[model samples]
Target: MPVSTVSIPVGQWFTDDSGRWWFDSGSLALDFAYTGAIRVTVAPETLHAPDDLTGWMRERFPMPVGVARSRDLFDAVSLRDAIGRLALAAGRGEELRAADIDLVNLYAATPDIPPTLGGGSRQAGRSVQTVGQALSTIARDAVDCFGPANDGRVRICAGGCGIVYLDTSRAASRRWCSMQRCGNRAKVRAHRARKSGKVALTAA
Candidate 1:
């Protein structure tokens, strides 16, 4: 039988870095690359390439990319980048600054998926905890493979990436990075509920 799924919650939402992660990791119009039909697996060397990072940045967080453009393809690269970077940093015990964390959070939040590779939380952290659980697995695995934070480098090297989706304050109670997509969705739902007077709302 197949392996059991991990739990993913909606509010279990995570931030990769800070601002970057806050944005829901935007994508482009022509994201055929993200279709489940594509068959690719994780390769260590290719993923670690500076080229990969550059290409990914251009693809998902392109200068032209924005919330309107946010799509599944963006999730593919971003989700991969996030988990991979975190795994690397965690493995080496690198101090993941905002930059580093942003990458991973993006990774976790993207990838709606063909069902094989981790596309992160579809439930946003609710459906049996599938998506959130996958991210947790990635983080936990990263820590197991990488190690504890080293000399606060996770904050420097990772830099804005680490804090992009996270709050910079002592409370640090931020998750997605923006109130646009998920947050707005929640608001819309609440507003609709108030208007319709629905006692219960379906999960997003």
Candidate 2:
């Protein structure tokens, strides 16, 4: 079967920094790469097939979804879009509609798949939970991003990649979601433009 969608930076969503469990871009990363596929199409695409959804969940959240079905795909897509809407609104400092918040709240209440503990001889173990719970937690994280303390720090990427991130920089002047990705691309484009302008001046 043909793969429906793939991700850039393949499966690099969750960042383990100094033994802390958090995304590098704050909670916004929960919806960053996955959510954009809801409205816009990426080059490799996001979640187009059930397998894609399963893989994304497995890689990003480190959960086993087994075989993802059509229904699971739909639910995943829906949740992603809801989170994205909230992130955008938060970044813009616009009050979110009651319905939007309700959507996320509903999913946050119940988990589709429960977790189970597995891993041999590690001194301790935990069971794997359902995928539904994993996804719900992701939504909850997105909601947390809208909290007062972090909301003001939220920023929509200026690179036009349709990603939102928490600007934790001391100066609070961060403009891109990832300096290695979006930031570098923006700089390269600007450099090229400046060079082009210089050439035009020489010609004139």
Candidate 3:
């Protein structure tokens, strides 16, 4: 199974410039990486202000995160980029940069949000005291996913989407990030090409 700090909803989808919905990349770190342009063809800049960061936190985590500050936003963007680069490198079998590794380690060193019980429900939730804690949690998840034992499972979508994801299939043969997004598009294009070729041959 892919490493994750929380349950990934099957319908958790994000829209891009083309209005196509794309799902999570199977981990919180990779999801964060997707909030902005990394290696992906369509980049979405969702973290523009402190409120943007907090809103994203609320969407991703079941618990409430502390109010984000301007400084926190800056740090979050930096960490996000570093995580993105690391994930793409891992997926492409490229060498991980030392600076990016150090940046991730620095954020991961911070204390993470502690789990709390009794939040109007029996389910456990996290108590995030600060934005740094929330970021630390994401950085730690990146560490786990990019580690030697799990890095091999990282894969870049083959449909030219440029997104990276964990290949958790039984045979580890997953080629696209999401079937509804890239996979179906690829199938349609192949079918069109075949039909065009057949028409040309009949005319000739």
lDDT of 1: 0.33
Per-candidate clashes come to: 57, 17, 0
Kindly list the per-residue Cα lDDT of model 3 for residues 64-114, writing each as its tens digit.
778899999999999999998888889889999999999988998888776
Error of 1 at 24 (Å): 7.9
Task: Put down candidate 1 lDDT per residue, 1-204, tens digits, no spaces.
Answer: 112122121112232222222232111111111111112221123333434434433343212221222233344345445544553344245555677565444443443212233456553322332232333333332232222322222221121222222123344333432555445556777798796665444332
- After superposition, which runs of candidate 1 have C-alpha atoms over 4 Å from their true positions? 1-50, 53-164, 175-177, 198-204
The model with the greater TM-score, 1 or 2, is 2
Q: Candidate 2 overall Cα lDDT vs. reference?
A: 0.59
Task: Let me know the TM-score candidate 3 reaches against the reference structure.
Answer: 0.81
Give the worst 10-residue stretch by lDDT in candidate 2.
1-10
TM-score of each: 0.25, 0.64, 0.81
Q: After superposition, how far is residue 56 of candidate 2 from its true place, in Å?
A: 1.0
Clashes of 1: 57
TM-score ranking from best to worst? 3, 2, 1
Q: Which stretches of candidate 3 lie over 4 Å from their true place?
A: 1-12, 37-41, 117-128, 193-204
